[model samples]
Target: MTSFLERARSDIGTAPIAALNVGARRFSAHRDHAVEAFPAMDDMRDRAREIRLHTLANLDRYLAQFADTLEAAGGDVFFAADAREANDYVVQLARARGVQHIVKSKSMLTEELRLNDALEAEGMEVVETDLGELIVQLAKDRPSHIIAPVLHKTRFEVGALFEEKLGVPYTDDPIELNSIARRHLRPLFLTADMGISGVNVAVAQTGSICIVTNEGNGRLTTTAPRIHVAMLGAERLVPSIGDMSVILEVLARSATGQKLSVYTNVLTGPRRPGEPDGPDELHVVIVDNGRSKVLEGQGSEILACIRCGACLNVCPVYRTVGGHAYGSTYPGPVGSVLTPALFDLDEWSDLPYASTLCGACLEVCPVRIDIPRLLLGQRRLSVQTRTGPMWMRRPLRAYASAATHPRRFRALLRIGAAIGRLFRSGWILRLPWRGAAWTQGRDLQTPAKSFHRRWKGRNRGS
Candidate 1:
């Protein structure tokens, strides 16, 4: 199985950031925004963490209550056991309606389940409504950041993508570029047969799904279409609207440094006869995918994540490789635990190790998830499964044996030091096979001979 980093290295390099007009400086802007947003992000993350932790600790009551509230409000709710099951439920609904077009607001869970691909396979044209997501979709690319899909790209790059893909007059100016996207997506909103949205927070008491965005596109997508299908991870649940308010406070602040997003939409069932705008049919697909496994395991905190991208901004590894390097829709420290815990472990085993075990992600996490702790635990599991390089096993086994027999370990170290003195230098003269992978991008500076050996020789000469 390939490590997550290795896979990321391959995919992110190849994926489109700024196809034509977009430039690499998209990453620099993301860094600037993150720094500017830090204060609010911190406060929001703390609030979000507390709310999720509180809810998770008492999940059963909340889940049952939330389901009841949604149904009572006239919304149809379907709980799916996994990704395929969730897609099947949505597909079945879409097919039953005999509609093909789908316009979706940005939702990472949708990407995780590859919902657009599934819908497209059945001949539906899935339109992305978020600006950044729209850019990536136009470029035929995957998202690179949690909040900003095209974070690794710049305005000029987006301008280029628009020129080539959208066939518009080419200009890299931000306002013109945004206007172009707005024009492009305008028709799809009205023409789409159904709207698909990702729920940000699910209120257990009222059975409402709250979606926040800067653009009003979310409202349009949920309203214009006759049928609206909302796909949400099961973790979105909160016991009450009041609790949702707290999470929302943190969510907006952490995600964009705003006290609140430009739009915070709370939608219950379908539109009542008197309602001005809303779908006639509202179907909520509560997707468990692999989330239940986390709920049942040591990863319950990971589910506490509200999809805020604060962790991404604060992560060093993320800063270096950007989101694509994680090779999962979710990136940064959050991806380290989430991708593996929710998906294939063997395929994603390297994600946890991609970190320097830095606490930046945790520090910025709205829900204050112990990300580094969880990442290390996942790493241990990977090692136990022998999912990584073979050489790790040899030293690990030797270390274990050493701990069991102290004297033997000491003697081995002494002997090794004696040998090291013969060819010791700042740079490694020779390396054991196990250490070769380390030399790929670095020169390992060798340690000096044991101080005790040098001391004994000096005393005899004196």
Candidate 2:
């Protein structure tokens, strides 16, 4: 199996790398400008963080309240402990409802659960309606960015993909490309029996689910089908609409630099008696999928994330290597802390190190999650569990030993400087062990002399 460093190296100097740079820079600029324009940005971020903290602290009460309110309003609420349960419930519901045709908006939960694959295995024709998601689906590829799924692919690449997959006239124009996608997906939405979506915020007070998006697909997916399934992460809840409003405010500015998304559809229940365009049956799936464990752990603060993707845009590591290198559903500074907390620490140990811990992510986050601290926490856990790579142990131990003694520390530094001087190229191209990982992407400049030596020489001369 290829390592994260290996995958990251492959993307460097490639078209995808260029695309990542452009996309990240554009989004980051938009966020900065939006925040600059809004004088209440700081206050809103603080409020949003407080709301998230309160909700997480009392998640059980809110979850129960949300479920009770939704159920009382003729909507079915299912609490899923894991992915298997969530997928099984959705699949069984589809089968029972005779839902052979399914259309979905951009749903990160569904992606995390691999819902499309599961439904497809049961002979359902699952179609993605979001433009970026459609492109990803047609190409059988994963989303590279959380909000902008196809940020890694250039327009030309998308044009080519559409041309090959949809058998359409090749055009790279953004407007024309969107038109083509709309032309293809509109019919599917009209004919789909079920529509699946991700809930951005669930209001426990009113039992309403808020869907935020830039495209019309979110609305169409929810209203177009007879059966609408909204997947809500157990942690994505607020006590009331007022709290939801604060979250939405920061989410839009942080995500796309808008005061509001083009569509912020809040659906309380299934169609009312007089409603013309609405789903006949609304099902809310509250998915745990290890989130409860995350809430109890050192990384509990991560549940406060609003999926704004602000961290990704401002993150240097994410900008450099892009999302696919992380090999997880989520990516960037948020993912570094989240993936390991949600999944296996040993398996995803590399994710925590993906960051430079530069604190760029914390600066941009809407909920103010301390991602660097959480990353360090994960690293500490990995070491305690002996899950970190064996190569790292000895070096760390040697450093720890030397750090406690001045003479040994100086001796080690002198030896390192002497070895560094042996390299004539002025840079160490390759390191002997785990240091090879560091040298892979950048050159380590050779040290001419240790700081101790220079200090001693100056003192003696003086």
* The candidate that achieves the highest TM-score relative to the unseen native structure: 2
- Candidate no. 2 TM-score: 0.94
TM-score of every candidate relative to the true structure: 0.86, 0.94
* Residue 250, candidate 2: C-alpha displacement in angstroms: 0.3
Instruction: Tally clashes: model 2.
Output: 0
Off by over 4 Å in 1: 8-47, 388-391, 398-445, 448-462
Best by lDDT: 2
Q: State the lDDT of candidate 1 residue by residue for 44-128, as single tens digits.
A: 5566677788888887788778878878888888888888888888888888888878899988888988888888889878899
lDDT of each: 0.79, 0.91
- Candidate 2 regions exceeding 4 Å error are 398-410, 417-455
RMSD of each: 4.0, 2.5
lDDT score, candidate 2: 0.91
Give candidate 1's whole-model lDDT. Answer: 0.79
What's the residue-level lDDT of 411 in candidate 2? 93
